[model samples]
Target chain A: MDNFSFQNPTKLIFGEGQIAKIANEIPKDKKVLVIYGGGSIKRNGVYEQISAALEGHQWSEFSGIEPNPSFHTALKAVEQIKAEGVEYLLAVGGGSVADATKFIAAAACFDGDPWSILSEGARIRAALPLAVVLTLPATGSESNPNGVMTNYETQEKLAFYGRQLFPKFAVLDPTLTYSLPAKQVANGIVDAYVHTVEQYLTYPVGADLQDRFAEGILRTLVDNGPKALSEPKNYTVRANVMLSATMALNGLIGSGVPQDWATHFIGHELTALHGLDHGQTLAVILPAVMAEKREQKHEKLLQYAKEVWNISSGTESDRIDRAIDETRAFFESLGIATRLSDYGVTEQDIPAMIAALSEHKMTALGEHGDITPEVSAAILKRCL
Target chain B: MDNFSFQNPTKLIFGEGQIAKIANEIPKDKKVLVIYGGGSIKRNGVYEQISAALEGHQWSEFSGIEPNPSFHTALKAVEQIKAEGVEYLLAVGGGSVADATKFIAAAACFDGDPWSILSEGARIRAALPLAVVLTLPATGSESNPNGVMTNYETQEKLAFYGRQLFPKFAVLDPTLTYSLPAKQVANGIVDAYVHTVEQYLTYPVGADLQDRFAEGILRTLVDNGPKALSEPKNYTVRANVMLSATMALNGLIGSGVPQDWATHFIGHELTALHGLDHGQTLAVILPAVMAEKREQKHEKLLQYAKEVWNISSGTESDRIDRAIDETRAFFESLGIATRLSDYGVTEQDIPAMIAALSEHKMTALGEHGDITPEVSAAILKRCL
Candidate 1:
């Protein structure tokens, strides 16, 4: 295992009715700023639950954070935060809302232009404290400090992270997700699965416990992701999926381990260019990357096949292919298109995505930092 | 899964040469108090590393924290903290020393009798900040806020926990454990294994991630634990073992799951009465406890039999018995006898141990609180 230092201080309040805990988690004296995407919370019971929990608390609301939260909109929230002097942020929807809240929190407190914090890798010295009422379980942003936001004008997607943005508390009531659409649930499952693979399926790091933890998240998603879609109201299935997503990217599985995030970096390019949902981009790109870089990640791919896919009897190359096939199939089963053509993308589009990678200086990616723009183009071509 | 809230804030600095980070982790202005066990760190060259790190920092030293960490001895450290007004503590040895430092950190700021805090469940409202240089891998007290210390005068062992008592940082330099005796290595393995099983081998609670995490820790220990004894200097093996022990009881596995620490509760009694090592007591008693509660814990036992021990080809009763047998055999292979009689704990010692349980009010233990004193006695009788 490599040398690493880790510390995550997000307190998770998880169960059926943990939303009511917002009353206790947030400070009584603080003026709260609640953030969410669209009006889903209002359509569901989450808004009413938050209203009831923070009944008399002094607070304001910022709606329409949007999926794949954009900085153009989050800047507005940051402006409101500064104008109203919002002391605390309550992110009350899915990961995008939480991501927006984190972005706003950082921007509100940043001494300089906060856009540079994402685009230029600026340091976040301090940010407003935030707590989460996670109605969506796609991104583990509720617990993790890092979040990705898009720049609509530049059509660029980027991520920013610091110790300052970790939620002070995260309330995960799986029942709140019962009202979510089947598509969103499927997206969540794929999102979490890819997150686990990003941290895992890289190299043998002697991080046995971390490997098991990563696989455990994968297995949990494989077993319950479909069940969550089929029976949205099943508390047990939703609870497992919800918890797995939180654990997937909460920094536990990646600690002291060699994590390959080539898929995510490449997938972000696709998301930026094609406006695909984050998980759909992942579903389109990961198998191609896995196939292209099979030799570099051969041993772990075999382990993933035997342990996660239960395909131990095949030849090495065959097992890797089967694992990738099973992965694409899993995403397809969720009503997602794993091939670029299925999503209406052609081989002609590969160069532009590869150019975007070059503009972003994405020459070195993955655990070995060898996923050059050429390699990325090859992976994208295979996706076609 | 049950409703649960969880948070652990201990910064884990893990790898070789991490000891030098103490200067950065602790406050520069605070007068530090360094604590450790009987000169082992000194002999292992850990002392030189710690001393070099504390070169420019103002610090005092306290030594001689025993194996189980005596509260009476820790009280003296509390007196020194009060006298010197030590603002922070640095525990440089194993879990016992860290446990003692926790006691001292809590007791120094405590208002009422500190013993009442242990025996009377006095609330801990404040504590001095502390960091650890962990030389042992048995107890996960480094990452967790809980600690167990023996009251030597009362012949009682008790645990104290509060959010305030968590270490600010824990430096896990795997090389520090390289000098440990083979016996200590075996004990660390058993201690970590039982800790995982205590949280795992009760009943399935829909906590698939947690169960897999527990099994992951168990599998790591099973695979590399013996290698830690044989090839003491193997960094990969020791790192896996060290990391496994920390993760085993750091609340990740136990979260939202009904944990069965009845074995630990019963095992502590044997430690207090017969002076056996904590891990030895666990090894001696856990198989018997599994046997005794086979009916109540049937489902989880079957799962454990298949997943952990791979003993699936038998009748339900036979598989459970075989699982228990495999557990005992694993401990025995560690060169630690798995029966109480081998440790000179005969059936005659059962009555006094039962009295200890009654004295400690451990009448109801296990996940379902079904391990009554009578049930515990029966388990002990079988161990004999």
Candidate 2:
């Protein structure tokens, strides 16, 4: 295995009625800003539970952070946080709100323009400490130090990272997810599965423990996804899904290995251009990316086939093909469309996407760093 | 699933030539105490690497912490640390030295008799910060908050736990184990395997991800043990074994699960009474414990059979028996004895071990809390 240093200090408070822990987790003296998206917490009783938990705390609320967590909305929250002298942030909704809260936390302490951090990918110095009441199980923003922020004017989305942005604590009560719409549940499952695949299906770097962990998360998502959709109120299904999401991108699978986030890098463009949901865009791009990089990722493809998809008794090429087919099938099983045309994208958009990728000088995409702009275009065309 | 709060803040610096990073990991201003066991590190060249790394630091060395890490030895280290005003500790040998450093770090800060903390098992208020340069791949003291310390004077062994004693960082270079004696390697393999099984083969606790992770570590140990034994110079095999040891007791496997460490507790007595190695004691005791608790641990044993040992075609009883037998065989394959008699322990030692276990009043010995003292004694007899 390649040399690596790993450390994640996020304290995970999981199980029923864990939302009440938000008050105790954050210090009593710190002024708090609770961030949410579209006020879903109000309808789901999460808002009431959080309010009751923080009965005496000096706090305020910032609502209506959008699904993709745009820079503009997060800047407004940062303004409110500065105005209120907020020392801590509590994100109470989905990954979007959690991601936005992270941005707001960093922006509150940043000296210059907050957008500069997103555009230039600046290092974060200090940030208001943040905690989360995680009602959504996608993105794993609660435990990881990564945030994907979008710019509406530029039609661009990009990721920024800093160790200081990890949540001080996250309260994940699966019971709070009982009211989630079936589409969101399916999206969460697909997002988590793709997350594991992006980390696992690159190349075998002799990281056996990480490979097994990634496969374990994928297996859990596949085994438990259908049940979660059909029985939304089932605590076991929600618990399993919640745990799977946390494990998928908590920096566990990606340690000591090369990660092919080429699918995610491409998926972000689809989300930026077509306004597709993040998870849905991944469903559209992952198989195509796998097919494009099959030669470089052959051994891992065979391992993924044998361990995850159970596609043994095949030649290397056959195993890779079957693994890619099985991946697309798994996403389809989650009711996600795996083709660009299914989302109403025309052939003309392919050129613009390729141009956008090339403008970023995005060569060396896969584990071997060979997915140049030309290869990216071919992958997108294959998706079409 | 259970309501749980999980956090591990230990920074793991892993892989080839990581010992050089030790200088940057520790604070420059703090007075440091470097602790070690015997002089094996000098022979292995780890001492020169550590001495070169400690060039600019205010550090002192305390050697001679023996196997199992007795409190008697730790007290001397504690006194020296107090006299020298040591602010931080760097444990530079195997688990024994690291475990001893944990106790010393805690005891140096406490005002009362140091042994009271071990005998009475009280919560520790504070501890000097500690880090590790792990030369051994066994006890997992590098990444965990628990440590076992023995009292040679009284012939007693006990485990003490305090979150404050968790290492701030651990440098794990698998290359450090290349020169270890064959006996040490065999003991390390058995110790790591039993650690995984202790958390796994109990009852199904709905911790699907944790179970998979535990089984993954077990499979890695089994797959890599013989190679590590035969090809001691193979970097990949040593790296895999080293990583398995860290993963085994890093609290990842016990999350949201009911863990049965009854084997470790029973095994410790055998080690204390008969002067056997910790891993050897475990190898002899675990199969007997499994046999005694087979009815209570039925479902998980069948699951272990199917997933880990691949013994699927059988009745429930047959599968459980086969799983237990396979576990014993795996330990024997590591060159460990599966019965107490194989190590020359007579019948007289059995009653003393039973008395030690009874004094601890560990009635709930298995997953269902059904292994009473009588059951434990019966299991011991089975081992004989």
Best by lDDT: 1
Q: Please tell me the interface RMSD, in Å, for model 1.
A: 0.7
In candidate 2, what are the lDDT values of residues A292-324, reduced to their tens digit? 778787888899998888788868888889888
Fnat, model by model in order, equals 0.85, 0.85
DockQ of each: 0.88, 0.85
lDDT of 1 by residue, A1-384 (tens): 999998999999999888888898888999999888889889888888899999778999999887878899999998888899899999988888888898888899899888899989999998999989998898899999998888888877788998999999999999999988888889889989999999998989888878888988999899888889888888889999999999999988899888888888888888778878878998988999899999999999999998889899968999999999999999998888999998789989999998988998888988898898988988999998
Q: For residues B214-243, could you state the per-residue lDDT of candidate 2 as single tens digits?
A: 888988888889888899988888998999
Clash pairs detected, candidate 1: none
Candidate 2: stretches off by over 4 Å: none
